[model samples]
Target: MAEFPRNDMATAQDWLRHAVAADAAGDVAVAEQGFLQALLLDAALVDARFGLGVTYFRSARYREAALELRAVMAAGSADAATGILLGKSLYLTGEFPESAKAFELALTSMPLQGDSLRCYARAKTYATMIAGNIADALADYPALAGAEAEPIETVIRDGFGLLSAYGHRDAAAALGQLLITENPDDVVQRHLNDAVAGRAIDHVPASYVEAHFDAFANGFDDKLVNVLGYRVPEQMAELVSRHRTAFDHVLDLGCGTGLAGAHLRPLAGELTGVDLSARMLEQARRRDVYDALTHAEALTHLAAHAATFDLVFAADTLIYFGRLDAVMAAVAEAMTPGGIFAASVETSMHDFEIMPSGRFAHADAYVMRLAEPYFELLERQATDIRLEANTPAKGALFVWRRR
Candidate 1:
């Protein structure tokens, strides 16, 4: 523990103890005051400054939190934990490129701490995802040294996991770090012990999803439906009403900017939406259609509220996952018994290759194979969703009832 001396008059020890006690009790106002008091008494009290920054962070005042945290760096005393929170705060307040700097600096600390390693790893993966380099993502892997790098490695693994979850790459590449450039000394770290080289998962991995959604968030809706002819949502809605009479809950997975939620309006008692992109979720939030909005990766959101929804809809969102197992399972987990799940996927029976234009297509067989386990296929139809740009795309709308 580092000794932070306040003034010769005030015992730094007493103020620090008070600050820590207040912070642990969730009395951040008291915590902030105590920390500031310490700082006032002793300007060199790095601990108190850090405690003050943390108070702002826990209160969600991220900008103010970052300012005080950054002061720690100026005082020449910093650690991985401070860096991680500060970096996260900076990123959340829309200082994206600056967030990257904070994360990198955290990594430079000798023997990376768990949180710091993970932050940097996430930053790198998101960087790639934002660039839309699906192929390059397949090859990038984090270098993990010890417990300190666990968080970073986790982010890297999750990024690759998302690529695999969405069927962006082959199973072999996903089972291990087969796709990443590596030396002989590198060890492959999978969350599972023997899930095969690319065992089917039940939910989309967090890293790839976070990056892909954020990267595509700005132009996502326009490009997918407008440029590519995405009509999955409307068609799915039509398929549902033709068969079932009522649905209590309607959820849009990867609900980008509420495009699907808008189509689901009439059919929904209440709509709940989730997406990996905060920006896209923000756009959806403005529509006033969905009852609740969450900025979480597709799988985690669905998994957290398992068996609570009556209807789950994913419109043309499955294309991002090369494998349907994890995401489908999440949908299954989230739906009530006898609940109906509707979704769309672009079809391709050929080799899983990124065309010169860079779009992925999966065969209908691949789609059915994944859904058969948890859902009874009630109706599936081929349809086109009219894009805002007036172009139509070919897609499959499948309605499945949970068994």
Candidate 2:
């Protein structure tokens, strides 16, 4: 086995610290060199890449900027700032559809103000105008979706994604429209189709959630933990431990890849994991922390296990639900008196809004109102849940006791 110095991580972090300082001090050359050195030491370090990408972006190096920024996003940082920068880079490179998606995600995180708003509008207008000519440009796309060789839905989605990647803005939009026309009742297709059309819908279908998680189940943990800096599982577990030493029965709702299950295992006498995605459940099963792993939607599983749990942990789960009324009532019914319900959620000002990203965010006040009748708020703390486009995404973590 090859051995190296034990301080590689410490040394890499030191390099990262220096790089950030240099970047902030406007020493682009030193900053870039420092970032490169940091990456050489610890290739998995995302901060170095982010800093390098920023430096490259500032230097009119759009291609390098785009490459590094894309890598940062692929690793799990999708904040408005990163998205905006990436969008600009791609746009400058003449990748309009890809740029549109980046700008769209950025706009969802935070609405563009002043000049940024004008720029966004310009981009949107250009993309829209280009889309009007897509049908004539990709005359065979509509026919390709109906081809008998592959699933119609698969063909359409893949074709749309490919066209977008290749900067075929209008063509991709046309394909998306075809998808909607062909699969009018298909929730996943409709939601994605709507996204491409820049429409925000109130409800996200269960099928969309299942398919999204299942598709990314394999890399879920790495993206969430390593890339995005997700700490909800650990944070929630720590909060729960502060109140209770152990739980007789614990239920993990929306336990994708068993992250929360793995954290809560030591505290749970019997851990049960539930999720909408079978692939996610399979990933959870491999962790072996859960005594039972069930493939079912949160509400459906909660309905079958009424008054069954002493503790229910739902980390990064409830964001899928825009309205918590039925699910909250169901959760209350499913919990024993005085049982704990710990969860984290994306924060928003409105009661609940399905953002352009297709996920829901609830205001703290709204969540409190929903839990008032059934769960007593034991603890609620606001924290950075993860990195979105290299920016800290705000979220609120709560531990409530069933009344």
Candidate 3:
């Protein structure tokens, strides 16, 4: 460890030197105390603030590290080291957009280091995933073009190769990376931060769903049925059939490639399918099951035609929604008196959580609570909605009757 020169008079500089020495010697608590003392002596000392921020980062206190580093930058004392640390701290704290900006600034100040490049790429990727901005996400990909040797790059390469063999590599890789990380705890913690901060949207963005399903339309059935063993359509159809054999009018919400539509076609006098993806609607159109297929979001399409349907089916679709209140209200408004709203959702212990897969899971009590005001719970059943990594994905199938 390197030692700093100390003044005999024990000024702020002396305190800073002692603090650095303590930090270098792995005495972070003592270093923190010394750094605070130095700051108290000379509040304008940039190095002391930076050192303190670094100490907090070393201790894995990312929020404090971000605060201290942000203060240092706000005070007009910016440097490559400070910017890199700030970016890393922000990324760890789940402020991805700000982290990207910090990394960009750091790159402008100095050449990209391997760690900084990895953090920058991850920040951009996360921001794109949250915002559903593919163009902006691709803009950052150029930065990673030469980052072939980085661990993240290696993971991404391997992920893409695997997904490519299965088809739809880009979308699959993005979703897969969230599930397959070197440190799942860190990724899960970031998702928790997103959920707690309300940074995770109530519903998965329409743009994201549209883009995903559009890209997936061609291979959707094969991937869902064969690869993932998705059986929600058949399961939900059976659940609805048990209650009623037929309906006057039916709405298939999120009717992705019309899997549910195919199952529910026999039960509907007039079946309408609505989805965010035009490509998905195109695929559904070819099925010739739905009388009408509209390219629109579920809630928006539901709200547009109120009291128009007796049965609304959303098989495996509600998993994209973190909060059920608004959607449930919309469904209630859209259905006729004594109408049935049938949906399936991934289950969780919490009221609702944004999972590492970027999907939302809801507790049974939470779903029921949201439906209480406008509808009555008719049926709820535990079932395997799909298979992930060859394991059953536990979920709940819900049927609600409009009050």
Candidate 2: stretches off by over 4 Å: 1-175, 178-186, 194-202
How far residue 147's Cα lies from its native spot in candidate 3, in Å, is 20
Estimate, for each residue in 1-403, the C-alpha lDDT of model 3 and write its tens digit: 3354355556788788889999989999989987898898899998999999999999777888999999999999889889899999987766767888888888886877677777777666655645655446555665663553345445444333333222333444454444446455443324433433345466666656766678879999998988778988989889988998789999999898998877898999999998888998888899888999998878888889989999999997888788888899899999999988899999899898765455788999999999999888889999998764334678999998889
Candidate 3: regions farther than 4 A off: 1-200
Poorest 10 consecutive residues of model 2 by lDDT? 140-149
Compared with the true structure, the alpha-carbon lDDT of candidate 1 equals 0.66
TM-score, model 3 to reference: 0.55
For the record, the alpha-carbon RMSD of candidate 3 to the native fold, in angstroms, is 16.7
Tens digits of per-residue lDDT, candidate 1, 256-365, equal 88877777888888888887778788778888888999887777888788788888888767766656777788889999999998888655664232211123445677
Ten-residue region with minimum lDDT total, candidate 1: 186-195
Q: Which candidate is the best by TM-score?
A: 2
Model 2, residue 298: C-alpha shift (Å):
1.4
lDDT of 2 by residue, 1-403 (tens): 1122236465888888888888888989988988898899888788898889899988767778899989989988668888888888776555656777888888787975554544444344335435675444344333322322334355457557644544455566687778778768767666666555545555568889987888889999999988778989989999999999698999999998988876798899999988899998899998878899888889999999889999999998888887899889989899999999998999998888765445778899999999999999999999998865344678999999999
Q: How high is each candidate's TM-score?
A: 0.46, 0.63, 0.55
